[model samples]
Target: MNQNYSKKCAPRRLMTVTALAAFLFAPASASLFAQAGAAASANSPAADSARSAARAADPLRGTPSTITSAGNEARTQQDAFERSHRLGLRFYNGGADATCEVALGRICYWNNNGDVPPPAERADARLEREALLEVLAKAQRENPKDDWVNGMRVRYAIEGGQAEVGLEAARACGGTDWWCAALQGLALHNLNRHVDASAAFGRALAAMPEAQRCAWDDLTLWLDPAMHANYKALGCSGRGAENARVFRLGQPLWMLPGNDLQNEWYSRFTMSRVHSLGRLPYDMQWGDDLLESQLRYGWPTAWSVQNGGAADPRPPQVVGHEPTPSYDFMAVPSGIGSPTQATAKDWEPTRKKARMRYSTRYAAGYGALPHQFARFLRGGDTTILAGGYRLMRDLEMGRAPYTAALTLDGFDGRAPLQVVRDSAPANSALLVPFSSTMLASVEVLAPVGKRAARVRNTVSPLPRETRLSDYLLLQRGDPSPTPTLERNATQAYGSTEIEGGTTIGIYWEMYRQASPSAPLQVSLRATRLGASFFQRLGSSIGLSKALTPVSIKYNDNGRPDGGAGRSLTLNFPSVPSGDYQLTLMVSGAGVTDSTTQVVRVNSGNK
Candidate 1:
């Protein structure tokens, strides 16, 4: 029996020693078993049901489908509200006054998913208001002079559409602050106190930070009708008058290259009002002739409002009076209105009168027609007569491309009129006046080369042969000059590749009856690739003085027979290395033609 007892005690003692050794040497293994058991228990259905119930009580839980799910969601939200409310109370009891108020305020205005029913939204809103009021009451008791708290109160009042209350709260925070002043302005604006609101906005603007000034300006522009009216009343002289001036200049002038027209018009209009008419509201700065001239001409010169007065009270200063040579008689449509029923015969007398009138004005050193005389020229039936006289003069000069007669209905009778080009031999245009306040002369000229002589060239024979024929040479200076009428021709030459600053020789022949004494006007223009459309348009309008000018006199004095064949050479200016187009326009008595060739200026000689 003693041996048996000893054996059992030995086994028990040995087992206990083994367990202590395992705990000391293999502690991680023991921890793994415990974690595995806990994980198994956590994944059990009972544990899952408990977790679902907990999630159902959480207001922040994701929504689920079904009416029952929605009800559970509502209950969970209520539980969350209660929990926050209790937590806030505890914080308040613990003497964290500000923190407690903030917590309560957050709970009151808590934003829930918009899927909440209308009743729930209303209830939540009421709870929010109550909580905010509680926060305000506590804040007032704790820190009555705190601007942050007062600002919150003001924001809350404004959010609730209580403008008067918002104003009171803002005033309590000191009306000098930008935010406070802005709030006061909004409140006043809402209450129909526009003057007071404007003052408040002004104060706010004065105090606003530089970074936020633009936002303030935008707000003022949007909300203040009186500000807009005041700006408009000042015309071109007030603080914001630049915008009004731009609008009054109209669209035709804006389509030009730069802001020269706009600036000149504003200065002239302001000067006329202030200096000439003694208008009090005009800007005196615009009256200084030296400064005005510098601003307009970019140089110190005499101020002359009469410069562009021929077209309008303020015409584009860049518009030159140096008319195109008589041979280049293409007429541009002037933006003047005329009577719809007037005929060309009726305009003959007016044309004669205007010629005399313009000559007298020019001789007298009066730059442009006086305002009254210009108005007279643009008034009544004489307006149509003026336009008619222009048309007849163009017709008589053989400048009109189309043989169409002048009909009064085609002219849109508006400023910046559109002249439609038609293929008919009889080119006819109508002028229909919509307004009696017509602009000065609206000269309509046909495109150049419309009635001019035809210049032609052949490229297959090196040193291309250029000549005049019954038809215009549709392709002049072209690497491949193919006559419209197919005559035998060889291979077409490729574009000329020349080094920069080198002169290219152009060879062409003139086929027409010409008096030897008549000098031919030749214009050679080089257009670089990627040039602006406006630049190209200016070139077409005979305004491009950049072109190289050339003149060739046909010495027919020795030869009685009219000369038909002629050749000419032009030296172009040094051009940069790039792709370019060289256009040659040749004009002589009753003949005008143009040809273009592609030129590639290589960087270095190949």
Candidate 2:
């Protein structure tokens, strides 16, 4: 036997013998034995049948069938071993091995005794510690220089709050073992040697396999400011290193205005990089839930573009579905007169009609607008402009433009409409466009409702130069709109109504000739009505405090077409049941504009 191991075992052996005697003679031993007998009886056929019936009635029961045969005895023993092992590590449970029958009995007794060991049972806990020391000493004697045994000794010492001893044992392992390194880190951390602890933790993480890393590893690294700071300083060099760096740098920027914008930023910094790193699938990832919640519960209205005018905003269901691509442009169906129409040359008219047909087929085949955008980006269709005015129009109005343009070509719309659904999948080809022959047979189909009249009034016989600058105003209830473009725009509320704990949604579009990359400052302010008394008091006191407005500031990145839009909901700290004026002011590129609306806040009773 190793001299050092023998010295450790000598006191442990004496303690173990005394513990064994006490365990055998304790008054509670009789009760424990009786309980064991009862447990054995409980595993009988009748008891098993009752258990099986209970499991059958349990809605949340696992898929596995209940075991009632002799196999159940083995399972019971296995469960007892697992339970005893866990309890032994946390609280002393007599000196029984994890798999020992006595350990199992002690576990059952402790559980039956309400998880609290009585004063008399405290002796058993001491015995369990002695047994553990004896077992560890024997293992050390078998292999005194084994790094794993030494690491385990360090863990045991740390668990017993002997941080200094744990550190000494950990040093003996030479930091090769991950557990020893981890224990050393913990000891150093407790001693306020943060820099040393961080180094030790980094070494431990380096030694651990990626698959073996658990929540505890993340918790330890994140919860320790010193460790996290060290990791940020030195740890980003592997496959996902760039992603980690970007996330840390960009999380602060996720406070942008809209959920869509915030999600775009978040996806760009985190999800996209994660996908690029092959850690997660691109389409399967989702954005921050809080942002999504804000969009859904804070603003519930739709904003739809109207020809030659501000968008006719409506509730979500009334607007149906409209796809908003990454560009700003307007499209009017054929036969409609537009304010910015260009005179069509002989060849230009035929080509314009053909482009409309192509966009229709593209939309039907792609199932999504972004897929079409991707194709445009790839230079797949060189005939189409990089900006692809034709594709943009088709996307903005769905099939409305193409069907309307084709109707004027002296062909029935039935044949071309049939082929809309017949086009191959967007992913089937590298580049797919509607064949010229197919376009020749197509005719334009007019859109329904006021949209038809608007289209007819706006469509030019020739290509037109249209400026994209336009303003839009929209409002909804307290809850926000959903994040998706198709679902976001809700119908504008006719009468503003406010109640207890309700917020007011304000949305607007500001058109400006400014750099798209520049930040536009927008402010939302609310002024309570009935300021006459304050105005009079201010006049008398020579202090102009009347009509003080509560406001919040937001920074917006100007849009692609020198435009900026915002949908924000506001709540006042203390709003009595009365009337108020809500105003939104936007400023950028040496210009500013403000719009105000009156709202009636009702008391809780009505």
For model 2 the local lDDT of residue 108 reads: 11
Q: For residues 125-187, write the lDDT of model 2, one tens digit per residue.
A: 445434444454444445444443454444445434466765665566532355556656655
Range of the 10 consecutive residues with the lowest summed lDDT in candidate 2: 1-10
TM-score of each: 0.20, 0.23
Residue 372 accuracy (lDDT) in model 2? 10
TM-score of 1: 0.20
lDDT of 1 at 90: 11
Error of 1 at 69 (Å): 41
Model 1 lDDT per residue over 191-290, tens place: 4444565566567667867655543222122112334554445533243433322222221111122232222222222222212211111111122322
lDDT for 166 (candidate 2): 59
lDDT against the true structure, each candidate: 0.31, 0.31
State the lDDT at 428 in candidate 2: 12
